[model samples]
Target: MFNSLISYLDSIRERDPAPRSRWEILLYPGVWALFFHRIAHWLFGGRLFFLARLVNHMSRWITAIDIHPGATIGRNFFLDHGFTVIGETAHIGDNVTIYQCVTLGGTNPTNGVAGKRHPTLEDNVIIGSGAQIIGPITVGERARVGANAVVTDDVPEGATMIGLKARSTLVPAETWLREFIPYGTPCDEPCEPNSGDRAESLERQIAELRAEVEALKAERRGDQPHKMSGTNC
Candidate 1:
């Protein structure tokens, strides 16, 4: 158990550079939040609803991070700087990193039944500060949600999402190859350039498809003339 705790702190150190030592990481509210959550979750699974909620409320009061006792979190989940809210049906995968003021929110049920309402975050995913991931969408593995982005749909694997509606930006090979990207954004260039390139690429592919269709039409026209001449003969 001691070794596992050390491993958990070491994982946080790899993601965050501000902490000088493992002891400093122990002071982090996120770590404490997780510790409280583990006990709460165990109680919740055992049908001890009141006790689970009690622990959850206490953890939120202390850490300023609101994670429901029913939320399923995997190993090495890091909530950097707190102020994050995770919903009841949220399922978090291993090594998922979420920044301050991020929300894993749920949508209102249309059928009046409470089911899986929150987002499912896959392994190695990073969510930036103030980013709102709403509804029951699945954020694919290694996906990055940029700061202040509002995402309502499923994020593709290895994609970087940005902007108000959260569109995917084309990440450079170098940026994609990196193990971790701070704030889930590329440092060197603005997202507009990548968006523009993606737009141009899509337009080029459409033009190529049109050209192929025109070539096929011309070939059919030529064959029809040859068939008519043979019939006349």
Candidate 2:
């Protein structure tokens, strides 16, 4: 368990430029969420459904991230920000990175389907902030789902998915990494306007991510954004 914590912190430090120390990492909601999720997932696997749900709720309260206890997440899976939701049947593989306000959600009605209603993300998959990957999709290894993309289909290995329609472009993941693009693929959104402090920058990123999520939701519904008060990406 301690090794896992170290691995999580190391992964974050390697992939993100945010954390200044392990002490600061301790306060991150993602860290707490992943920690308790391990216990919750164990309880779920042991068939202790009631206890698992209780742990899930507690984790949600503490972390503000809703990861169903039944979801199977592999090593070094980092949920970069809070408000991320992973569905019960979702399976995330090793070294996956998911940013804020993303959802690995169900599309089919529970009453209508008997099996996996969520997505399976393979190793090294990076889901951008505010992306929604719904239904029983298989996102292959090293594939990237862009910010605000609504994916409902299988993604080929090393592909880059863009937009609500999820138009996929097959690019070798190795080549992309060789190019040194941050976050696996080139992002669509512009860089956040330089905020003075780390806290301010974090808050600004969250707001941008949230707005992108809302805009994507609106696009899928074929309507204008409901909240007209703020600038939306």
Candidate closest to the true structure, highest lDDT: 1
lDDT tens string, model 2, 20-90? 99778778888799889989999999999999999999999988999999899998887888999999999
Residue pairs with clashing backbones, model 1:
none
Highest-scoring model, TM-score:
1
TM-score for each predicted model, relative to the true structure = 0.71, 0.68
lDDT comparing candidate 1 with the true structure: 0.90
Off by over 4 Å in 2: 109-113, 166-233
Candidate 1 residues 1-233, lDDT tens each?
Answer: 99999999999999999999999999999999999999999999999999999999999999999999999999999999889999999999999999999999887654568898789999999999999898789999999999999887899999999988644555557655555442343323334566677799999999999999999999999899899999999
lDDT of 1 at 74: 98
